[model samples]
Target: MNRHLLYAALDAAERGWAVLPLRPGDKRPALHGEDVCPGIGDCAGGHRKWEERATIDPDRIHRAWGDLPFNVGIATGPSGLVVVDLDMPKRKSSTDTPNGVTTFTALCERAGQAVPATRTVRTASGGVHLYFTAPSGVRLCNTAGRLGKRIDTRAWGGYIVAPGSLTPMGAYAVVNDLPPAPLPEWLSARLTARQASRALMTAPSAVRASRYAAAGLNAETASVRHAPEGERNATLLRAARALGRFIAWGDLPREQVEEALQWAGEQAGLSPRSCEATIRSGLNWSIARNGQRRVA
Candidate 1:
């Protein structure tokens, strides 16, 4: 048993964060997936996701962490925290690319406000996680690049590795000791806009003529949204290609299909630029191949 990790889990819970166990030196949850759920213990009622299984109880924490050197995962929704994850660009060596910190700082400057000095964690990949208290009466979901490039948020349906967690890249550690400040009004306003924009995307559903097309579109987007990290791009590409056939058959509009798939890819953690490129490529390939058959 790693006492240090045990302390870390307890400390987070002490601060009211719901904690869960992650694989040692990895970000993935240590809990069983629904596919292998034994229908006992936590899942006796049904399959409990990591978010539902997350707990603040010390006994649960101790029991889970005592047997292995498991890393800690904080379920942001249950903890009533919204964490802003500032990610580094994938191409670190390119000076042309801006990291999340730089873009976020510039965004704050444009809004005539400074970056809020809140509880902050420095991620192993040289990025930052700014912790904030979720505003009362408002439930926000996770977003990727909704604010800007390389900026993501973890709220309902999302989780983050706590300080003292280790991964192959490096360790997560607290950089600022300040208690989380209430989410800034400007940031909150932007998030609200995100919700509105998403609503607009669904407003065009009347254009969908076929139930099969609608079902296919919904299924593909859901697959992209829930895809694990390493598989996100491939899933997005495949989803776009599958939907392209519907577009060629005049069952769905190309613009609407592209927009929906793009948003799904971003929510699944792909960059906006990458999502657009992949979606375009996949749609082009599929439409070209399928359009000829339609003509024939």
Candidate 2:
């Protein structure tokens, strides 16, 4: 692997927040297990290769940035970062064409409008990474929770995009000599608020405790009954956001629910088959555990 590309990815992630690099060796605190690339190429080689399996330590990335506010990173190749925008659209298949490209294009267009100097385009992997020169006088947040915790853009090593992994065509970018995108004050505030909301949702311990209290159940019982439901509900809401909807769960139509669930599954890195099972299980669990109970 070209260390330059790796550093480039790292630098990109650093623009958004502080990042920890996970490579083949060198273990200060090691992440658990070998990363499973899934349908992407093998990232185990430490260099870019075919598009079947790319691997990075998700646990480590999560852990490293868990408490920090709003950190994001790249997961595959020397130049990719994991971008978690609640605004990102959800789809059924990771390899689904047009959808990925369309989303990428849309994001780039928005970014261009937001910061004209930061022009971006699509990558072959169907994933888009927006690039910009380091802006002067702007100190980007390096922690994980600053940008509404809902959006994460960090460069850890496990995520795989196209051409580099699953897509045969590979990733492509629209290059322009553009200045770094300026972070708008209003946008930054909104993102920060969103991150705060995300923190509440992902805070497992706090959520479990709250559920137990609300359901009048003990911790152990709540662990099984309430906790998973809470998680499932949050996941579903995330799905809805990815699908670009603003309605509450009860307000969503069945078809929309199905589409959102599929998109959520893709974000979770689940296969199409797994996504189906997950959606079914989540819905069933919700009904069984909270019959006639409304989810706020």
How well is each residue in 68-169 modelled by candidate 2, as lDDT tens digits? 222122332233323322222345535543343354345546656332335343544344444433323332222222332223332222232211111234
Clashes per candidate, residues 3 or more apart or on different chains = 0, 45
Model 2 misses residue 3 by how many Å? 12
Runs in model 2 deviating more than 4 A are 1-116, 119-121, 125-127, 132-166, 177-179, 200-281, 288-296
- Score candidate 1 by lDDT: 0.87
- Highest-lDDT candidate: 1
